[model samples]
Target chain A: MDPVLLLDVILLLLAVTTAITAMAIRDLLGSVMLMGIYGLLMAVIWADLFAMDVSFTEASVGAGAATILLLSALTRTGTRERTGGDHHLPALVVVLITGSVLIHGTSQMPAFGDPQAPAHIHVAPHYLSQDIGKVSQKSSDGATRRDFGDHVPNTVTAVLTAYRGYDTMFETVVIFSAGVCLVLLLRPRSPLRREQADE
Target chain B: MNIDGHLIAALLVLIGAILSMIRAAAGPTSYDRVLAVNVFGTKAVMLLAIIGFIGDRSGFLDIAILYGLVNFIATVALLRFVETKRLT
Candidate 1:
C-alpha cells in the first residue's frame, strides 16, 4: 500500500482507540490530561489531512481551553469515583443495531477519493477550479470562481459568516443564554445573601 | 513513520476517553464529573479536527479555532461564577 493510505489507516485506528480509552480510565484528572494529549494528536492527524485550520482550532480549544475548564470544575467539586456498573442490555442492543445499519450503509457510498463521486464533481470542483475574480459571475464557468480576497480562505468562515451568518448569530445568542442560565442556576439565593448581610 | 504509531496514539486517546467517561458516570463529587465532562469535550474537539483532515476539508479548521476560543471563555466564565457566585 502507498505510504499515505497506510498513514491514514494507522491514524484512524489510533483515534478510535484513544476515544475508547478516554472513556474508560478511573482517575478523573489523569483522564482529563490524557484527553488533552489526545486532542493534540488529533490535531496532527488533521494536519496530515490538509485541514490546517481545523487542526489549529482543535489544538487550541480541545487541548487547551476545554481541559482547563474541566480541571477548574474539578477543583470546585473534587475527584473520586467508581468506573461504572453493568451495562444496560437495551442500550447495548440499540448500539449494535445502529452500528450494523451504519456499516451496511457504507456499501452504498462512493469509495474514498473516487473522482466520479458527486462530491468531487459538484460543489468541491466548483471551489477548486474557481478563481477569486469571478465569484459573482453567473455564467456556468464563471460561477465556479469563488474569490477569497473579499472573504476568508477558510471555507467554514465563509459559510458561517456569509452563507449562514444568521444561523451563527442565533447560535451565539444561544451560547450567551446558556451562560446566563448557568449563572442563574448556580447562584446563591437572595435570602442567603441577606442573611450574610445581617451578620 | 509506520501507521502503527498513529493507531497507537488514537488507541491511547480512546482509553483516556473511556476513563473520563467512567469518572463522569461514577464521580462522587460534582467537580469530578465536571472534570470528566471537560475532558470529553476536549476529546471531541480533537476528533472533529481529525475527521475534517481525513475528509480533506481544510475549512473545518476555522470552526475548530472558533470552538476553542468559545470553549475557553465558557470554562473560565463558569469557574469564575462558581467561585464568586456573581457576575463580576
Candidate 2:
C-alpha cells in the first residue's frame, strides 16, 4: 500500500475513534480532551490530504481555540456530565443513513487532483495561471486585448485576498462576533448588581 | 511499495500517537489525560513535518510551526485549568 494512503487511513480512523470516545465518555473533562485529540487527528488528516491551509486552520482553531473555550466553559459548568438515558438507537440510525448518503454522493465526484475535473475547467485554470491580474478588454472593432498581469507568484494568497476577499472578510467578521459574544456572555457581573442584591 | 525512512518514522510516530490516545481515553486521572494530550499534540507536529517533507511542499513547514505554537499554548492553558480549576 502507498505510505501516504496508509497514513491518511490511519489518521481518519483515529479521528473517528476519538470523536466517538469523546461523545461516549461520561467525564466532561475527558470528553473535552478527547475532542482536542480528535481535532489534532483531523488536522493531520487535512495535512495528509495536501490541504495545508485547511490543516493550519484546523490545528489552530479546531485543536487550540476550541479546547481552550471548552475548558473555560467546563470551569463554569462543572466537569461531571449528568447521566442521561442510554437509548441512542434513533440517533445511530440517523447518523448511519447520513454517512451512507454522503459516501454515495462522493462516488460521482472526480478523482482527487484530476486536471480534467469540472472544477478545474472554469475559473480554476485562470487562478492557477500567470494571467490572474490581467483583464481582457474588447475594442470597438471587436478586437480583444489582454492587459499585463501583475504576476502574483502565490496563487493561493491571491485567490484568498483578491478574488475571494469579501468571503474571507465575512468569515473574519463572523469569528469576531463570536468572540465578542463569548466575552459578553462570560464577563464578570457588575458591582452595581451585587450591591443591589445585597440591599 | 518499498518503505522508506520517512515512512518508517511516520509509522513509529503514529504508533506513539495511538498509544497516547489510548492513555488519554483510559485515563485514571485528569493529569494522565492532560499529559497524554500533550504528547499527542507533539506527535501531531512531528507527523506534519514528516508528511510535509514526504510531499515536497515546503510551505507545510509554516503550518507545522503554527501548529507547534498553538499546541504549546493549548497545553499550557489546559495545565493551568487542571491546576487551578479556573480559566481566568
Best lDDT among the predictions, by candidate number:
2
List, residue by residue over A71-171, the lDDT tens digit for candidate 1.
Answer: 65566454544756777999999999999999999999998979899986877655544443335435576554446545457545444444476887897
List the pairs of residues colliding in candidate 2.
none
Task: Estimate candidate 1's alpha-carbon lDDT, on a 0 to 1 scale.
Answer: 0.61
lDDT of 1 at A71: 61
Residue-level lDDT for A123 in candidate 1: 79
TM-score for the A chain of candidate 1? 0.63
Per-residue alpha-carbon lDDT of candidate 2 for residues B4-85, written as tens digits (9 for 90 to 100): 8889999999999999999999999999998999899889889988998788778878887887788888888888898999
**How high a TM-score does candidate 1 get?**
0.51
lDDT of 2 at B26: 98
lDDT of 2 by residue, A1-199 (tens): 5789989988888888898999889999999889888888898899899887798889888999999999988887888988876778989999999999999999999999998999879877677764565678887899876654345556675587465878978999998999899999778879998799789
DockQ, all models: 0.08, 0.77
